[model samples]
Target: MEVRLFRRDETDLLQLSIDTLWAKNHVLSRDKQLLNYMFYDNPVSQEIFGEENYGFLGTWLDGRPIGLMGLMAFDLNVKGMKKFGFAPTNWIVPPEYRHTGAGLLLMREMFKWNPSVVLNLGITSNVARMYTGMGGYHVLPDVPRWIGLLQKRKTAEMLLNGDVKFLRFYQEITAVYNQTTYHVERRFDPERWNACYWATFAKRSIGFARGASFINWRYFQHPSFTYQLFTCMDDKGNYQGLMVLRIESILGGQAKIGRLVEFMANDQDSAICLANKVVEIGNENELLFIDFYCFSSISSWGLESVGFKRVLKSESDKLVVPTRFQPIDLETTHMMAALYVSKDVQKKISLIDDQAWYITKGDADQDRPN
Candidate 1:
C-alpha cells in the first residue's frame, strides 16, 4: 500500500472513498463546489502550502484508493504569531482495509508536515480514546455549550414537551435590552476585521487565526449553508466584534433555532454588546432558542451576563437539549476535542489551559450541514 498526499485533480478518487466509507450522501461527496471551497480555496492553506497543495491524503493499493483522510489547514495563533496547524476531518477506512494500518499510515503522513499544532474538534468517544492512548495529545472531554431562551414557554414546549418546571425561574429573564452603543452590519469589511484581529484577539488569544480571509471563506463563501454576519462597530465607527449566526429549522419546520457559530470581540464590553444583539435578533425572529459552543472563559462570562446558561453535563446526558438538528437526533452528544501542540509552541502558549484558548463551533467541520 502507498500512502501519500492526493493531488487536487484526484477529487473523483477521494470522493469514492468518502461515499463508500464515510456516508453515501455527505455534502462533500456530491457537491464539488463545497468540496473545493473547503480543501482548495482556504486562504491560509494556499499561503502556506502553495496554491496547488490540496488537503486530502489517501492510501492506494495497486493504484486503487482504499482509505482517505481530509485535513483542514490553517494558521494558528500563538502569542500573536502565526504557526502552521491543521485539523483532521472525514478520516475513514473501510472495514476490509482497517487491519492493514492504512489509518495509521495516513496519520503518520500528516505528521510529516510538521505542523505546529494538530487540533481535532468534534470527535467521537472512540476517537477520543485513541487520541488519549497515543501519548502527547491533550484531550478535552467536552467543550462548553451555552443556551439562551428567546421565548421561554415556547422553547420549553418544543425542547422539553411543555416541561416549564425547570424553566420557571428563567422565565422572568426577559430578552429585552436597552439600545446598544454598537452598530451592527450584515456585511464583511475585510480591512476593519483584520485590524480588529491584530489589535485585540491576536494579542492574547491562542486558537485558529480569524483574519478577514478566513472569515470570508468560512462564512460568506460557504456553498452549503447561509450564514449571517453581524459586524459590530463602536460609536467611533471602529470595528468592535463579529457574530456569525444561522437560523435552523428543526422538527420538520415546527421549531426554529439560532445557531451562533462564531463570536469574537475586542474586549468584554464588545462581547457583551454582541451577546445582547444576538438575543435581540433571536427574539425578533421568534426563535425557539439560541445556542453557542465554545471554550473560553471570557466568552462564557459575557454570554452568562446576557442570560445564556451553560448546559451542564448532567443535562446533556439526559438529552435535555439535542445538538444535532439537520435530521433531528435525540441522542446525547457533546463536542469532544483533542490537541497536539509541539513542544516549542507549548513553551510560547499554554494550549492545555481551556481558558487560554478561543475555540468555537466554527473552528472545524462542527457547524457543517448534514
Candidate 2:
C-alpha cells in the first residue's frame, strides 16, 4: 500500500477512483475542466502550494488507486495576517478499503502540509462525528441560513403547503430604502475590491481572503454556473461592498429560486444596498425566494434588516425550503462544518463564536452543481 500526494497530471487516477468509489457518473469524473478548475486551477493554491503539490492526496493498493481525498486550498485571514487554509472534499474510501486504514493515511499526509487552518464545510453528520472523535476540532451543527421571500404567495405554496399566514411579515422584512449607489458587473474590479478588503475586512474579519483574484476565479471562471456580481458604492463612488448571486430553477421547473452565494460589506449602508439589489434581482426575475447562508453577524445584519430571516432549526423543518437544487431535493437541509484552527490563529480569532467567522455558500464546494 502506498499513500502519497497526487500530481496535477494524474487526473486519470483521480477520475478512476472517483468514478469507481464515489459516484458512477459523477460530474468531476465526466468534466475534467470542472475538476481542474476546482483543485488545480485555483489561483490561491497555485500561488501557495505550487503546481507540484496541487491538492489531491491518494492511496493505492498494489499500484491501483483505492481511495482519494481532495483539498481546496485558500488564504485564510487572521486579523490582518494571511495564513494557509484548506477545505477537504471528495474524500472517499470504499467499504473494502475502509478497514485498511487508507482514509487515516490520507488525513495524516494532509496534516504534514502544516496548514494554519482547515475548514471542513458542508460535511455529513457521520463525518462530523468522526471529526469530533479526532479532538481539537470545532464542529458547528448548523451554519445560519437566511431566507427572504420575494413572492410570498408562491414561496409559501412551494415550501409551506400554501400557508400564506405563516409568512405574513414577508413584506415588512423585504422592505428597503435603496438610497445607495451600486453597479452590476460580470467581473470584479481588482483595485476597488482590494481597497475595500484592506479598509474594512482585513483588519477585523476572519475568513477566506476575498480579494479580486479569489472572486474572479470563484465566480467568473466557474465551469458550471453563472453568477452575477453586484458592487455597492458610496454616494462618492467608492467601493464599499459586493454580492454574488445565482438564479436557479427547482421542482422540475415549476418554480425558480435565487441564491446569494457571497455577501460582503464595509458598513451597514452598503450591506443594505447590496441586500436591496438582490431583492430587485429576485423580483425582476420572479424568483420564489432568495437565500443566503452565512456565519458573520457583521455581514448578515444588513440582510436581516432588509427582510432575510435566519431560518432557525425549529422553523427549518416546518418551512421545508430545500437547500440542494441541482437535482431538486425536497427534504429540509442544514450545513454542518468542522474547523481546526492552529494555536497561533486561535489567539487571533475566536472559533467558538459564530459571529467572528464570515463564511458563505461560495467558500467551498457547497454551491457547485451536481
How do the residues 45-96 of candidate 2 rate in per-residue lDDT, one tens digit apiece? 7775577765777898989878888899998887678887888886789998
Model 1, CA-based lDDT: 0.79
RMSD of each predicted structure:
2.2, 2.3
Q: How many residue pairs clash in each candidate?
A: 0, 1
lDDT of 1 by residue, 47-95 (tens): 6556766688888988888888888999888758988799888678888
- Superposed by TM-score, candidate 2 places the C-alpha of residue 160 at a distance from the truth, in angstroms, of 4.0
Native-structure RMSD, model 1:
2.2
lDDT to native, each model: 0.79, 0.80
Can you list the residue pairs that collide in candidate 2?
173-307
Q: After superposing candidate 1, which stretches have Cα over 4 Å from the reference?
A: 165-181, 315-317, 351-354
